[model samples]
Target: MTKKRKSRGRSKGGKGRSDYVECSNCGSRVPRDKAKKVTQRVSLVEPTLARELSQKGAYIPVSYVTKYYCISCAVHYGVVKVRAREDRRTSYNS
Candidate 1:
């Protein structure tokens, strides 16, 4: 069979199996390695209030919200971009 991606679209190299995560947008079950994970820092205080608190030397707390998206949802949400045939084999971070 012909292959489209070297990793078969998953990052679980040499691992037998990976856990599944639900897509935040679609609620679909997808492999943890295959899903697109997005982490966002959320401020507990409003931006204006946070700024004011910061000026007063008050400590403002922030939380990290992690979201997972399936391939379809990721593409729909613009989390991942479709690449050309040649570009598909190249790593974006390289």
Candidate 2:
């Protein structure tokens, strides 16, 4: 597993994850319905960089990847939009 980074309570540094916190970017609170955990790894290929894959019928995965809040529980949580990097693959992640 990748080593955990420290949370500045905003930009960085939080172990594994905690109950909840406010989204620094949006100042929105989120619920941390915790106890269970999820993990994933993704590659970033920016719009211009992802174009090549689109030409080949391949697509990059899109996600929020930003520190955010639950907007419900007044806690901190990670938010992702889960989209396709390309138009053709918009229906799925490649």
Candidate 3:
């Protein structure tokens, strides 16, 4: 049978198994490198309030939230899109 998808790369010097991470949306286990990682800033204060505070020279606390999604969830959430045969080989930068 012919290959369905293009190979990412050769694992020439890799170890046996890889580390896994839990998908934030579906709670499924996915390989760390294969998972889609997303980082978002969560603000403790409301956006309007935070803007007012900032204008007043007040500090607003924000937290960086990181989430990982499996391939299924990533596609479902529009994080990635199905590409054409020619576009499939292109790599994307976050």
TM-score of each candidate? 0.88, 0.27, 0.82
lDDT of 1 by residue, 1-94 (tens): 7878777898888999998999999899999999999999999999999999999999998999999999998898888899999888765556
Best by lDDT: 1
lDDT of candidate 3 over 11-69, digit per residue (tens): 22256567899999999998777788899999999999999999999988889999999
Candidate 2 lDDT, 8-58, residue by residue in tens: 123323445545645444655443432112333445887677888888989
Q: Which pairs, if any, clash in model 3? A: none
lDDT (C-alpha, whole model) for all candidates: 0.90, 0.42, 0.78
lDDT: which is higher, 1 or 2? Answer: 1
User: Best candidate, TM-score-wise?
Assistant: 1
All models, RMSD in angstroms: 1.5, 15.2, 3.1
Misplaced by over 4 Å in model 2 are 1-20, 25-43, 66-94
lDDT minimum window of 10 residues, candidate 2:
3-12
Sorted on TM-score, best first, the list reads 1, 3, 2
lDDT of 1 at 91: 58
